[model samples]
Target: MKYSLQDLIDMEHFQQKLIAVISKSGLKRLTEIEHRKQIEKSENRYRSILKASLDGYWLTDTKGKLLEVNDAYCRMSGYSEKELLSMYISDFEIIETPELVAQHMKKVALKGSDRFESKHRRKDGTVFDVEVSLQFRPEEGGQCVCFLRDITDRKSLQDRLESLWSLAQMTEAGPKVLFNLVLEKTQELTGSRYSFFGFINDAEDQLEVNAWSKEAMNQCRVQDQPIHFPIAKAGLWSQAVLERKPLFWNDYNLDHSRKKGLPDGHVPIKNFLSVPILRNEKVIALAAVANKDSDYTSQDVSQVQAFVSNILLLIEKRIADEALQKSDERLKLALDSVSDAVWDWRVHTGEVYFSSRWYTMLGYEAYQLPQNFETWRSLLHPDDLPESEATVFRHLKYAEPFEIEYRMRTKENQWRWILARGKAVERNDQGKAVRMLGTHMDITERKQSEMAQYPCQHPSNWYFNKYQR
Candidate 1:
């Protein structure tokens, strides 16, 4: 149709506007469909992952009511999908308080994530340990998703690690301290209600109750009693100690032989384990665990064996340390008891070693003694210095016993008669003196007593006096 220029421009503008409107509408429809498909695909992928996970997964409302659960959750609880769908999380939780659950949920809601451990009951009423991580998301109406993993085995391992750590700490302490620690740790690790330790007294040849847990000691009245088990007796712990092996008894009441062999008024040994503390292939002590809730297994035996081995080492070290301490004490006593003072001389180094007792006897402290020979020479009386030095020189040159009577000044500046006797204990290859050990004695009394006797001028005078008497 023929039209005016203005009409043609309006028509062109309307057509272009219509085309733009149509294109915008088509684009919006395509975007909406793509977004919906993406959301669906993401949801499916999440569900698939959750279902395939080994750890159980659950979605709950803020009140902790279970809204959805994955296959793993159902499997862990031994419940059917339909059954779980109808049940709330609180139904299977061993926690009785709803307030605690609310508190846990509140933490998750506030922080967006939380983790905790709690006990969960199975369909058969058995309780198991579970570690749970709860994450809060705003998109799903603020629902919380929980990731749960069974941590029973992990807890057991942690307990074992703690026991081992305790044992290591105890090893550094003394024997009595270590024995007490062992008793406590054994009761804790084995979940035993009672435990005790007894050591064999070598001189008395009797078993003595060295340490016991409070519960065990109370029940057994072990404090006043002597723990005597005859080697010929077939007692559980006695036999284990003699054989140097671990012994385990499950249902001690059912074991008639053990029941008959047990001592009178003894605590009923139920689900017990015992191991020997061995040294030099002989049982020196016995450690026993009693009244365990679970049946003792091979693992228990192995663990007890390891613990007892460490105990044996600790005991042996303790004994050795005690012996060393006693020996040191005896040596000190011996040094103090002697009337003479001991001295050591290093010839090559020209160093003098004096005992504390020597210094004290001389009215001086150990620090007063100079490390060199000059100090002693300075203290010698002038008259005796030349004779003493001559005697020592002769002895060193001839490899003979060193003996000299010298006068030394005391702290009071009085000269006292001292008999110095020494021998070269160590010698060089050329037979020269390398070291000398000696004793110094206060011989003033003896010399004065000798001088008190009547003296004869000559042999004829002594014989003439005797003939007259």
Candidate 2:
């Protein structure tokens, strides 16, 4: 039953009802304060999770304007939280233009999410590659949430793989240019201001320059100098070569006795590193770098040594290739000097390489003859093949040098006496011939002259007797 307002006002207990109504109001206010406290506690938990994330993250409106940024995002951008929160998402990208970012966001909304690698510009004006995952939330008025992971280290590995491939391609460039490239790349890779590379000469006493980088030359401001840099003249460069290992001087001034000081116009070196290029325990070349920004450490020494060790195979191969080329030239000159022919047979492959002089001796071009045993069999006299084969088999079996006089059919179809001398230069574990090297010389005139002087009734018999195999 409801009491009328006049009835309540006239009752004596109306003041007690007023107190109860005020008490109910105070209880409702207390409940609301507890609810607000719970909400604040949950918000704090959410913020802590975001702040502790390893990946950088931020929230943006559909218009790409940044609404909220996490601590990670601030740290990643090299910016403070207040500064990043004031900027737009588009402002962080170094590669993506404003128009491009707009297009990306449009596509991302259609796909619900998108992930890609792009460069991000830091506040310090440096850039690094980042993997960005963008998510669009239709529930929040098309807001975009993004997570970023830095991939600069991953990119560096890819770059190193490319560098190895480039080094492989350097093989065809010849050892001289290849060495130059190696030195230049080493200086750049090691962050050195100057590079020095010297190769030991034939005398084995002098260190001559095989390659010098243009950058080192430019940095040192030298004119047609730093050439040779003899082993006796240079201090650390020579010392490294003598030690047959890598050496580093963190401070050249502290050890004045070891340092001869830089020559006029040479680069003023700071921390120094040097390594000897070894082949068969012999120091054949020297490589050094100097003038680093900071003091050299044991890690620097190890890094340089590892780098040199990595490319040692290529360096040795290049040196061998150069030596082989020079050897071929000298062999050619020697053969030409004596007007002799040369042939080498690789037994394993059953293939033969004939020198130009060998082909010219038979009045045939080098390319005209197929590089196989059949070429020799076909050009040799039928009677001479059996004897030559028997002689070769016996020599290979006995490990003896085969020196025999045989008749070879020339291009003109005339029989010419040739003195063939050959030996198995390389062998396998079983003592079987893997390779054979030899030379052939025309002895028809000498035999004929001996026969003429003997003046026997049978000219062939006289020639054989006078020549005496």
Candidate 3:
């Protein structure tokens, strides 16, 4: 159609507008297609990631029935996909029953998400620890997505550390206490129902049963558990000690030539593990656990070996401490019988530990004065002090002989002759004496007799002159 110049311009404007609208719509369509592809890619990636995850991923209804399970979960639980789909969480859960599982599901629904630890039973009935993280989606037909990670090894390590810490704290509690703790911890860490700890006698022919786990004692029907038995008469359990190695019997019920039927009223054994505590390739002690829910593995053996080593150290330390204590007691008795007094001196600190006889010899109550060099100095007779100190200084500096007869003031204000003999017990890095141990004997009578026999040589004058030379 023909029109005026203004009408032509308007039609041209309208054409331009139409072209712009078409271009804008085409761009919008292209953008929508790209967005749809991106969404599909992301969904595929999410599905692939969920399927390939090493941790078990499963979807269940609020009631705890499995709706979908990943391959990883099927493998972890030792069940086929079809079998898992037909079962409920209660079927595989060891810690929580059907009712408890339902309660947990409700709690997760209320909280939207939850994380917890629980034990689960495998298809073969072996129980293991699992850590579960779950999210509930009410919009998705009240379903829950859950991820489970096996934590059996982590839990086992935690148990070992806790047991070790406990045992370390009880190292000084006595051998019986340590032995009982070892037995209890062995059972706890290995999931055993019974355990025992024992040592082989010095003769190497007898087993001295030291302790039994409380569970073992409760279940054992023996009228009286024997504490000592000849190794030759023992059953296969003693083989670990005899062979000087560890022994494991996953199927203890099976007949073996060495299986001397258990004693009457003994707790039935299904599986057994025995580990020897050896030093220099000789078995000194044995630790054993029995009746685990599952077969014992090398890990259990290692755990028991660590425990045995710790117990051996504690036992040896205890023996050394006991022997040292007895030696001290005997030494004290010997000194008392001879009426001598013991003294330990820390030269640098001027601290002195004087035995009770040291005070009693001076006619004073034990520890009546501060045990220090100043106290000894105050008690020394002034006339004998310079000679006595000179002799001590010579001995400390030159490692010369240290025997002297000095006069000390007693509680009764009487000067008594003291025969003092000592030797450096400890030295510094510079070879200087830092500690000295010595004995003191009241020698007033001997001195008096010597003076009476030799009137020209007075006891104090004789000692002073000899030390001076």
Candidate 4:
């Protein structure tokens, strides 16, 4: 239609405005498409990564309803993907308390994450342990993603390691202390209700139950019984000792093939494991476990073998060390009981060592005494020094037995007569004296008594002198 000049301009302007609106609409569409593609790519990558991950992945709503689960999750539960998704997360929980789950969720809500370990039931009605770590995304409508890992094997290994560690700590204690520890550790490791440890008395040639776990010792009626076989015979303990290896018996009572030598009135033995305590290839003790809750496996046997071996070594070392300590104490006591003062000399160095008693008998303590030949020379009387030094030098130079008479200062600072006697007890390969051990006898009283008894002769000569008088 024909219009005014103003109307024409308005129409042109409207046309330009419509073109701009169309261009803007096209750009908006392109942006929307790019955004959608980006979202899809991110989702696909997330799904791929979740499925390929070693840990099981699961998503649940705030109500704990299972929304989705990865293949790993389904596999862990022994269920198909569809089945897991159809089931609520609460359905798999061994604990039915919703309050606990809610509390955990609250923690996750506050911190955005939570982690715990709990028992989970599988599709096959079996139970397995799982460690779960959950992260919450409130922006995603309070959705939670949980990562679950099967830790049954890890838990079992941890338990076994703990048992072994307990055994080791127990064995570190002395034998008398370890007796009960060994029995208890064996029972715990083997899951046995009863266990006993018997040591063979080398002198008596009899077996004695030195230690037993709680009820095992009480239930075991045989103690101090002669070890016989087939009838009141030595059980697994004897067998292990003879074999020097581990023995496992599943259903000892039911196994007709097993020879029965159980004592009368004794409880029937069920599953049993036995190991020997060997020292220097000889079986010194026997450890036996019985009435296990389950059949003993090769793993149990191996663990018991290791346990027994360690126990044996510990016992052997403990006994040897104790004996050595006892012998050393006895020697020390003997040395202390003697009247003479013992001394040790390093010949090559010409250093002298004296016991505490020797130093105390003199006017000094052991540390206060001079440790070299010069110290001894300083202590010697001027008159006796020449004779003593001459005697010692002659003996040392010729490698002969040493004997000398010297004077020493008493605790009262009085001179006392001492007879020193020594011999080279140790020598080097070149026959040179390395060590000289000796003793010093306080002969002052003896010498004075002899001098006081002057003019006394033997009985026959005394009778002749008496008759002449």
Looking at candidate 4, the ten consecutive residues that score lowest on lDDT are 459-468
How many clashing residue pairs, candidate 4?
A: 1
> What tens-digit string does per-residue lDDT give for candidate 3 at 1-469?
6799999999999999999999899999999999999999997898789889999988899889898888888888899999999989999998888998999999999999999999988998888889999999987679999999999889988888887787778757877777788887888778899999888877678888888888778888987678997888889988887788898999987887767998888889999999988877677888999999899999899999987788679878998998999998887667666678988899999999888899999989988889998888898888879989998989999989999988887786767889999999899999999999999998987877777688686746565344323
User: How far out, in Å, is residue 74 in model 3?
Assistant: 3.9
Per-model CA lDDT versus the true structure: 0.75, 0.76, 0.87, 0.73
Q: Would you give me the overall lDDT of model 2?
A: 0.76
lDDT winner between candidates 3 and 4 = 3
Instruction: State which candidate, 3 or 4, has the greater TM-score.
Output: 3
Screening candidate 1 with a backbone cut-off below 3 angstroms (N, C-alpha, C), the clashing residue pairs are none
Off by over 4 Å in 4: 1-41, 56-101, 115-132, 139-141, 148-174, 200-208, 218-244, 247-256, 259-272, 277-284, 290-307, 329-333, 343-410, 413-438, 443-469
Q: After superposition, how far is residue 19 of candidate 4 from its true place, in Å?
A: 8.9
Provide the clashing-pair count of each candidate structure. Answer: 0, 0, 0, 1
Worst 10 residues of 3 by lDDT: 460-469
Query: Which runs in model 2 stand beyond 4 Å of their true positions?
Result: 1-55, 62-83, 90-92, 97-99, 110-112, 121-127, 179-316, 355-357, 365-368, 381-407, 414-419, 441-469
Q: Which candidate tops TM-score?
A: 3
List model 1 lDDT by residue over 1-469, tens digit each. Answer: 8999999999999999999999999899999999999999999999999989999999888878788888887878989878887877778888646777778778788899978888888886656689999889876667998999999668766777777777666655788887877787777666688787887666324567778778755666334465565555445556576556788787776644434454455566667888776667666777888888667777666666566667667777887988998996787578668878877889889898766666666678755777667877888877679979888878878866787877677786655668899888898899889898888888866654554463442222332233223
Q: Write the per-residue lDDT of candidate 4 for residues 1-469, one digit (tens) a residue.
A: 7899999999999999999999899889999999999999999999999998889998988778788888887888899988887887668888746767777677788898888889888887666689999989886679898999999768766766786677567544788777776777777666778877777665324567677677854665775744322312544445555555777778675544335457765767767887766666665677778886557777667666666666666777888888998997787568767778888789788787776667766767655767776777777777778988887767766866687777765555567778999887887888777887889888766665664576353222332233223
